[model samples]
Target: MRILIAGAGIAGLTTALSLHAAGLDEIRLVDAAPEIRPLGAGINLLPNAVRELADLGLDAAVGAAAVPTTELVYFSRHGDVIWREPRGRAAGHRWPQLSVHRGHLQMVLLAAAEERLGRGCVRADARVTDFCRLPTGRVRVTLAHRTGDTSTTTEVDALIGADGIRSGVRRVLFPDEGPPVWQRQVVWRGITKIPPFADGRSMFVGGDSTWKVVAYPIAPLPDAAGLVDTNWAVSRTFVPGEVVDRAGWDRVVDPAKLLAALDGWVFDSLDVGALIAAAAPFEQAMVDRDPLPRWTFGPVTLVGDAAHAMCPMGSNGTTQAIIDARALASAVAVEPDISTAFVAYERDRRERMTLLQNCNRALGPEVVVAMADRARSVIRPGPSARDLDRELAEISRRYAELGGFDVAAANAASSYSVRRRPHSARPAQQPAGS
Candidate 1:
């Protein structure tokens, strides 16, 4: 079957690989960018995403490029420890949670997809403009060149919209849905060389819902002065009706301004102000769309940020996208037809993504930090210390389970890999020569 994937980002690239592994070889990936470069800052891949990468036979490469995170610790605005737990293999999952630069991970996936699917299988400078279901049960996708008004079209058995939050495919599918809904929060993300904190392997999240900072080492090697390359994000929520223009990921923001947002937050292990001062960060408004009633419309379906864009609260945005790719490929390989596969894939992922979207909106596991801060001054006897500890752990545990990264379920979860069948390779489909 001829398959075309829109947006050559992590989600789209991984989808191509997953489809190839499932024994479906006719695949093409197109992106709006003229070139795919190593860009962006650090991102955490929970054990669940790591497992999917493992199934794709990419675990070794990814692990090599990233630091295996050992634990996650939540801290209050005053730098008091609120909750802490082991992560990845340390948490009992077979796979290790990895912290790596987003650009590095994307490059790894891009290399694998191109190697397996051939150089011609992936193309840049071609953006998906629109698509329609033809009478033959195939999709006619319109492609517009980035350089000029020139456009082309191709027919494919299926189209996967992994185009991210501002997906044009999603726009044509739900034109009236409008731009992503900003949650009145803004985040400044960057990586800086700083003294390693917490054994250089722990992910630290400090502050509460209104304002918070997350930092972790993305590299395994430490430089002189015992410093390691650390990734950090400082996020703050504005007033309910505050105005925040939807910004791209590449917008630069003043590091001083980000440090100012922290309001003098410093932990015994790390000083967030120093971290921010050490590097410039790109700024973006934290935004997401409401869960759609359906992601499948005939032979086309949405995945990743296109189908269910959630706030980066849970750090599962990339993880969920990778899972979507795997699940889509699995369904397509097992189901009787593309239509059935689309419906089945939607049915399986939409619910989970919807729950995750809502959970993120509710602050996910980070809610515990806010709760702990509030509990500091409770003259009225509420829950005891032990009860509160259980409650805090439960909050974190529930979010992990919902994201499919909880230790028990993740360790026991069956692989998403589909058995490969003997099939002849076919070149990617394209419009007739210009």
Candidate 2:
């Protein structure tokens, strides 16, 4: 069947690979951008997403480029280690949670898609204008060039909208759905070369007034270089009716502003102030969205940010989209009728998407405030240093109590394989030059 997919982001690329794995042919992907540019900063590939990448033969490439995060440390305003816990493989999960630059990850996926799907399978600068149902029971997509030269329409057996939050396909499907709901928070993210801290894993420091900071190492440099590609994001409550000016938004943030926000943050071992000061080319905020009612309509369906764009607090946005690709592809492979495939795909995904969105919303406020307060406390000097080992133990126990390691069961129950890889007759290769 011929398939037309909008957006060449993670969701769209993964969907193309998944459909190809399902033995479907004639897949075409389009994006509004004239050229695919590296946008966003970093993303965490949870165990579930790692498994999906493994299925597509991309685990080796992606894993090689990422830093394996073993622990998640939380801190209070006074740099006190409030809590810490094992993560990914360290937490007993079969797969590892990889922390990498979003741009690197996108390049990896784009290269793989181009290689496996052939050239011209994915097209940039092709913006979807509208869609019409053909008498032959097919869907025709009308597209326009970014240069405004000419418009063309192509017919396909089915269509999938992976076009991100401001998806045109979503508007075509659900005209009543207005703009994405604002979550009243602004966020700033940037990557910097800095020395690793706290076992070189990832850290989330929460403070008062709904301010939070999430930082993780993306790549390691050679020698005693002491340089690691780190990504950090700061978030706070935004005023109602605030408009984000794109040009002004992209302007570098004053280090003093960041320092003031994180003033009292006292996370144990590492100095939060030093870390924030070290980061450069700061990008400003415009965080998340409220939930959507539905993500599917007839032969066309939505995935990723297009369907359910939520706060990045839980690190579930990209992971869920990858899961959606797998689920939708599986549904299409099983259901002979195109409409039935779309229905089954939405049925399996909608509930999970809602759950994720709700989870993010619930956690957003507390986490944000905790981060802000922690930052302020560090500079103000208020509390006694908490015992590190005892605090970490308490956190680990709490995670265990909360069933943090039960991700396998959750993934299995969704009818999606946590890991999907074809068995090979030959054993895997050893270290290079072996």
Query: What lDDT, from 0 to 1, does candidate 1 have?
Result: 0.84
Worst lDDT 10-window in candidate 2: 425-434
Q: For model 2, how does the per-residue alpha-carbon lDDT over 2-23 read when each residue is reduced to its tens digit? A: 7899999999999988877766
Candidate 1: the clashing residue pairs are: none
Flag regions of model 2 displaced more than 4 Å.
221-224, 238-250, 263-266, 281-287, 364-405, 410-414, 417-434
Model 1 lDDT per residue over 103-124, tens place: 9889999999989999878888
Error of 2 at 321 (Å): 0.8
Model 1 stretches with alpha carbons more than 4 Å out: 241-250, 377-383, 413-415, 423-434
